[model samples]
Target: MSMNKEGRPTAAGAVTAIRTAALLPDEPLLFEIGDREHSGVDLPEVEIGEDRLGGFGRRTSLDLAGLTEPEAMRHYVRLSRLNMSIDAGMYPLGSCTMKHNPRLNERMARLPGFADVHPLQPVSTVQGALAVMQQLSDWLMTLTNTAAVALSPKAGAHGELLGMMAIKAAQEARGEGHRRVVLVPESAHGTNPATAAFLGYSVRSIDARADGTVDVEAVKAALGPDVAGIMLTNPNTCGLFEPQVIEIADAVHAAGGFFYCDGANFNAIMGVVRPGDLGIDAMHINLHKTFSTPHGGGGPGAGPVVLSEALAPFAPLPFLRRNGDGLELVEHVEGEALGRITAFHGQMGMYVRALTYMLSHGGDGLAQAAKDAVLNANYIKARLEGTFSAPFGGQPCMHEVLFDDSFLEGTGVTTLDFAKALIDEGFHPMTMYFPLVVHGAMLIEPTESESLQTLDRFCDVMLELASAARAGDAERFTAAPHAAPRRRLDETRAARQPVLKWEEAEGRAEAAE
Candidate 1:
């Protein structure tokens, strides 16, 4: 690989325009320094005639790049600086709650009891860890007011699959396995329909009302005996709460169906609304989103699905248990419990972090966090409504505010252009063109963590962009993000023609240069 002038890896195939090197000391592909007799570390003395790999290996030379220790360290350190991480600044991506992850939680997660435990350790030796699990479960039960919880799911989408599996198992046990239609609101998260459909259920979309909330009558009309369930997201993708959630749940249950609430938005209503009391049969709580756990690279998330009394019996197995004086985890063959979803206990690190966040923020603090999340969104809405167009302007939203491109009609600025322009203003862009119900949707969620001053500054930048759009400055909008580390890219081409590998060859650097 050749270091392009822009400091990115350059290859020969599908080459773009060549430019003079802008970044200094641009290195060539690592293969350029490979040698037959070079090695970085000393190897121990061993017999060369030993039959390793059963004589099926060593097809070619194990050539690798050689570099000094300092060069390697500096290379990685410089690359790390190029990344935009939550540790660097505020991450304002909507629908993804990126909040402040306390350093205390990190410290707790790294403790030997949590970080050094093996998945296959003896249950007796790991009783303390199991107790941690049990305690977390008790808190989850108390917080959601639910009967039971299954803690094996890996993430929000994986948890949705588990909730649907429980519903299916319950239906099969009742000899009503033919029910296969899942009613999903149009404004629900995209994964809701995909999860239901993947489980062989027909997805029927229900259009939201003009106010961005689900219409109770529409849901009632859609209910039938074949309905498996209704998957909905309260404080929906449009950031509006479905006030008729209880009625919708009742209608679905009356029709012999369960209610699967996508709890990804739980951060906006935690400790304020207990989903169990709201008639929800099952819901998944994204621990990473609401509890300030570090969201790894799209993974290592814990989504524990809480079940109502009616559905608790069908929860997954291998849950934590507490005896009179000791703690234990039930992982063996049990009676009629759904089998384990993961190989061992769920992500212990995430659990510890989530618990630490919850214990630090008691009941009132959580409620206030919910309240502040809503207040911040409304503040943004109120500040930007005059400049931008709100699709549903009359009522207050929950945690995020949705804007469409109606105000830019004659000015010709699109939602994508406006979002790209935010990158130039030293902020990550909001979610754009999602929730497909609203045209040119821009969903911005400023969690409870943002200060009033920061929010005002963001609003000022948004207003300036809105003014530019209103003044028909479409050229400036189209070529946006001029101040970012990189300029605007052809996203469509990048997605369609993905370059996913690196191979070593000669003349790669010269051709790229």
Candidate 2:
């Protein structure tokens, strides 16, 4: 509410408010703010002549721009201030697991030896770095209860490729290369099918039951002698653990097929359940997610894969081995090993950070973290299940809660509008319209990093927004994000004709130089 200079409160969704950002106001692009002729350093002018430039001689003045030291620094600082990070507030993105990155891990990752050591440095001088990798591998193997771990793959997708490659190699070595089909559940990550197809294997989709889980009978029906394996996410995208995962794995093995599990949701049951115990042949553990390394923004990811005894011999090369009281990096492919995945062993900084996180929180602490994560998600579900529509009833979730837009069917407010309106209340919207199994899906994961007070505030705002939508406040939902720097955009037009460059975004007034 605002006064109109008459000492009277205005109405809700009125035009009395202004759409200006409190921070980073009027921040322009580098081209818009820089001068075409200014510079921070003196440069000798180049002479332009036909002898020097030949057919590439200049026809028009080049619009090369420059900025002073202070201007360049402040421009980036302003843009950095506009970003929304997990450190700033609650980040409820579900399947991605955007949680807090501990500062202590950062401090350890920046230590002199760990930060400055080269991948090709002398093995004797960099024994500590190699030791870090070995220790991380040991922890991963112990937690997942697998026979071996390959730490060279870069990220989750890369690790999937490694796991699938191992499965393929194991089948070929035993003369079962005729298997060509890979079964992938719809609830699994999209990368699961892509990785299988990239490896020249046929992808077959498996159906999910009404409770948002895979049925063991469905897996049994899909299995055959030509089937290679099954790629499944245990705690699926619907935020419910696949109750028949063990049975599915056993059935797949009965048909001479491998089991590859996508470990993206290992954050939900890291210390509580082991994938190997469920008859999984190969699984990739996302160090960036479950182990608390840097995630998002093109950050480095370490996805070390754990292998069962059946597939351990086909693990990737560049593994560490003990050679009479000294550690040796086995770079050569010996008998049946898969070739190297990368030029080096793995991401060193990511290994350091993940190990630091593990050491800081012992076994009990990690188990508690998993429990608290599930607890927080269930708490949010219990609070919002009545206001919103949960596709899967009121059952307890793993580490996230999934909701659909059934509550706003006749209210004229869509799931997108509700998400956009959430921006007005100072919170990042939950992951929306995902998993593709439910209509207008909204998945929220409040990692154990959040406090009860923060959860209450988020829930209160959510309830208030639900109430507003139910009351037919169409204007509020339609024209939302009133407090952000920019207004709602023409999403369809933007996607069809994207402005990739600054000049293109501003309707370029200057011609090509």
Candidate 3:
């Protein structure tokens, strides 16, 4: 409706226009933009007279849309640009440890000998690859000061399962298989409880103390003949090292229960501390997190479980062992082993990359990486001390800092709101509402990857946002990410009304928009 002479507002529901410059442009799905008959490259047509699939054959069209080579290249390149990657900037995703993955690791991982070897190749033929695995295991064993390392768990959660399985196997060997409970701390990684439950162990929650560390007395009270083990994370989700961890470990041992340390926070203490020294029975070290391989894409990860002497015998199969002249892959489960957790001998690319990081850093360098990680996190805590609310304030944190939404209480701003606004300021949001213990948790882990200048810039932006929220600038946050490649989304609605297929409502892809 055009404005009248009075220039009063009309019934026109005209939406405010967003500038194209502020948008990352809609990238149509291949199914939406490509022709089904189009081919990126021409090929000679060869018609098969006989069906090799026996009775099984394609009865319907695949309905795959094809694009030209340039179009396909451009599509992926556009998608990559829209991503928030560590290589693009500092990724301070607490607990996840989004630190810099050195290019040296990548180059080593891509070497012909490491990258080209197949798992099924003859043991003699893949000596170099096997040597890489052996070197990585040796480094992990040395770093953690553990008895053995299971190098085939594939990822962190898988490694957790392996660790617990080893615990169960050891218990059963000692005729104590009746143990059926796994104590999980509230501040531990969520996977701890899930892994315990998945393995048929009843999960008992041990509450965190006022300071965010696990309650030791709670562990003692929960201990019994039925207790299998306690899963704990040192330098826990709250980013504070458990000062009473040794006491907790001893108590659990006295009660005939093993201790499984969630090594997710190992980045903070890799060189300075060792889990074996703390009496940990089994722990899974994420090669991607501590040793610095490219992390978090749902693929190409390694979580080799370091085992104590008690649990070492039960370590999983497909591990590397020295065979006099060369390294050998123990493909079959021997003694009290947990058998095979994965189909192959683990992620080879991750092994090479992790080893490269170790060789490049050496012992002292790895320790300093841990030190710098803690320093960076503490730096963040110090900078945002009064501005943002630290859940466990006035204490030096590990590799990450935990902040709550208390500062935004009266400002009508939320943790999520503040995070969305951060995106507009050219940064990926910190991990929010996690560890569940804190009300509106914002966990930031700068790792050792970030420079001093980057941390200062990030702190400046955080302070400005905090000040704005306190000044009753709720609209600024509520309507945030106004200048991001995309805009804020109603995540709940998207989850509830998910359009999984490309054929669904034509514009469903733009639901976030």
Candidate 4:
């Protein structure tokens, strides 16, 4: 073994250092692990009668391969160790709110009553599940001080579409269908503008002031008879709260336009501030982020949209109702509701988890979680302020901290390079080049779940990396993660021309020959 300057073992004479050596040999693809003749299990052959056979019957052998029970178990366990998750270490992805998912929530979601109940079951059979949905809805509405909630949108972006559709429906009801423009702040979530455009509304860009919050005057100037509404994210993407939110909301309402608040950042102000009281007509709460459900990785997530009385009348249907008999779904748009958004009720498992989180914490506990999240973010900002450049320096951030790469100028190290280097330090990288308002953006959201010990360790690693960059040690960042299973990839080519499907190595070898 050869040691580098840091006394870490190096692979051969390469300048790069390997952090941790793999315990097992390099894992092969599943297809490569098993033979075509192998079968993992014994099964009885099925005999198809000519009368029962159809054109779908296979005439040739299938392409499936099999592994033994032990081999299959080991294969997955090794692959899992190669991936990063919230369980492995701290996930500091900003704006996405990749917080810890409580085991208690998972335990409750796995209960047979909650997990086994199908959406197509009889109403009376799944009364408990229906009650859970109603309870979750009530909790969300109470937290936001809104009149009603539609617990059917699949995720945050889906919830935005639902809210915008409600706004459009209300406008058309009042014969304002010509209000075709929606004002979105440049600092708003990327989904805000996409949702507006998807709803056939022209999106007008509202500029953010130097402080990273939307300017009230810019919003007023954009409001007109043709303006449908404004989609604003409170505690906006810069990790700073919109100070002029009330003024902007009042202006939009005064101009006969609704307010669609993107509730993606509700984790920072769950009990601290209510959007409804701020004159917001509609908002969507991401259960995965605010409440403690598993998020991302093709999630089974939920984004319930809470509506004000002005917009509640136009909310989507298939909502829960309490008749004289028991809790039942109003499967039709009986009253002033717009049509249904999803075919079935929303994600029941996510609903159970969110409600479990709420009941376990209660109102006061939820408020403290919000406070702690803000405190954690501010703690990070205070520690890394001098080493990194903060775009909005004077104010306290809500639940995340935003840093620009101005400090890295002339260091010959880019933001992407720095992020990749963090992987070699045995930690996941903070979100980079996001929220687009600032140049070379690096956003870090340390949710309230992390302890001081973990945070300090993470901060120390970041400071060390910063010092290396300033000292002109470009190799440390440029050739990073030599310990990982693979090395840096050509990101531009990967994004522009992705090979979505798997191709066998043997086919490639034959083609080359």
> In model 3, where do residues sit more than 4 Å from their true spots?
1-23, 42-57, 333-336, 504-513
What is the C-alpha lDDT profile of model 4 across 330-405, one tens digit per residue? Answer: 8876565478889898899999999999999999999999999999999999999989999999899999999999
Q: Per-residue lDDT tens digits of candidate 2, residues 139-239? A: 89888999999998899999999999999999999999999999999899989999999999999999888989999999999999999999999899999
Q: In candidate 1, which residue pairs get closer than 3 Å at backbone N, Cα or C atoms, i.e. clash?
A: none
Candidate 2 stretches with Cα past 4 Å from truth are 1-21, 35-40, 44-65, 335-337, 502-513
Q: What is the TM-score of each candidate against the true structure?
A: 0.90, 0.89, 0.92, 0.91
What would you estimate as the lDDT of candidate 1? 0.82
* Candidate 3 weakest ten by summed lDDT: 9-18
Q: Rate the local accuracy (lDDT) of all candidates.
A: 0.82, 0.86, 0.85, 0.86
**Candidate 3 lDDT by residue in tens digits, 50-89:** 8889889989776765555555666687767788888888
The Cα error of candidate 4 at residue 498, in Å, is: 0.9
Clashing pairs in 4: none
Model 2 lDDT, full chain set:
0.86
Q: Which stretches of candidate 4 lie over 4 Å from their true place?
A: 1-21, 35-51, 68-71, 297-299, 335-337, 505-513
Candidate 1 segments whose C-alpha is farther than 4 A from its true place: 1-53, 62-73, 335-337, 505-511
Output the worst ten-in-a-row residue range by lDDT, candidate 1: 11-20
The CA lDDT at 427 in model 3 is 86
